[model samples]
Target: MKKIIITVVVILIFAIIAIYCKFILGLASQMANPKVSTLEKEMSWEKEHKLWGDYDDYEKEDYIVKGLNDYDLHVTLVKNPIPSDKYVIISHGFKSNRYGAVKYVDSYIDLGFNCIIYDMRDHGENAKATVSLGQFESEDLYKLIEDTYNRYGNIKLGLHGESMGAATSLMLLAKKPKVDFVVADCGFDNLYDLIHTSYSVAKVGFVLPSVNTAMKLRYGYDMKKTSPKDALVGNEVPVCFIHGEADTFILPENSQVNKAATEGYSELHLVPNAAHAQSREVLGKAEYRGIIGDFLNNIDFK
Candidate 1:
């Protein structure tokens, strides 16, 4: 009987270690090497949808900045010739590059706001290859905002982000940067909750808590600290939350909770029948552009 009990204990210990290594450490590595969409596929989609109409014809500049822990970030500046003091820094989603901002670029340009689109670390042209979810990504945003302020000098600034980028934008709010408005599209509320929901369908929910603990101990990433819902609480910055009603990946309720947590200072726009970041594409250019334009115009930013 004693031998049987000892054998069971050994098996449980081994299982714990296996779960930690496989789900925790392995998951982090997988996130760092997400499958990126090819240029051909991106161009085909753009052509079919007429997204970013004539974006190639615009004048652009290449900008680079150093992020936290010496990580390098690659950025593209889309110039607006209207000579306005308004500017926007747009951050793309997980596993996506600055090219993902194609749908929103033309509208911002038409609205006379010069746009800056950049790649997050571990994705696109950025030299570094690591995913902190949003812990370090927020630091990258700080550097970008600071550089933009230095270059433009006290201009009206807007911060916009999608998915993981949206989380980073919200996380940055904890520091209260000098920006007129924020647009977070399809952002998750809590990193840990998001991970749990993503893996629950795969029957991996039992291992996720252990995985998060392992990530904290081994990788120094406290997943619980990366909550956008918590960040939005009492945040005075004018925020516009855009999400799809059919979004199961991150869920529409997360945005609803975030908007509610903002103490009635934020606006929530749910696009019917849209999924993930497909609000713009699904709503067609006119309606989507109108929503964004109205939000920007109401902000009273020049």
Candidate 2:
């Protein structure tokens, strides 16, 4: 009986160890080469459900922009005929490219704002497939902002980002804090929570902590360094946080926490029955446009 008990204990220990190792390895692999398959899935769902709204006709210019650490980034410049002094930079979520946010181009363009959309380092037309989330991608956005300013001569700037892109935009604001206004939609407050939630949803238990440890080991910064909550705290920039009430991926509370963290002008809009980026879909095109238009109009874009 004693021998059997010892054997059972040993088996349990081995099982735990195996699970930990597997989780760490999986996370490391994903961190080294973040896949955009999830983004593609969401996009396919949106298209099948006819979620995206009609976009205004605009000329699209494809160009290669310089990224951080000598990496080249790809971007699509959507220009409006009016050519107003205001510019809006839109960033897509994880595993998504500029096209994912194309539905928003027309609204901003209609308001006489030049819209610039770009692919992150690993996703879209970008050459690399590795993503450190927003750790490194934030630098690419900063460069794009600088390029925009240099060319357009310090025009009023607005940033619109969803999910990972939203996190990246918040980090940019923390690092620079110069944007006239920001709209963060369905973004996670902390990277740790996001990783844990994602793994849980995938039925991969015990992977979150292991992956987080490996991330810290591989890169100097942990999830806290990439936290939008930390970035938004005490920030004086005008920010609008739009969240879906039924969002399970990142949870609506994440947006609430981030909204609370902002010390300056901030507003939160919880879409009643929406899920993740489904606010626009649930609210319909006209209502969605009106909400965003009202938010933009309320901000002093000087």
Of the candidates shown, which would achieve the greatest lDDT relative to the real structure?
A: 1
| Top TM-score model | 1
Question: Candidate 1 lDDT, tens digit per residue, 1-302?
Answer: 99999999999999988866776667765654567665456667777877757689988998787778767888888999778788999988887788887778887888788999988887777764557778889988998898899888968899888899889998899888898889999999898888888889988888787777767776678778888889877789989999999998999998887887775357789999999998988987778778778887676656
lDDT of each: 0.83, 0.78
Model 2: worst 10 consecutive residues (lDDT sum)? 49-58
Pairs in steric clash, model 1: none
- Candidate 1 Cα errors over 4 Å, as ranges: 1-20, 38-44
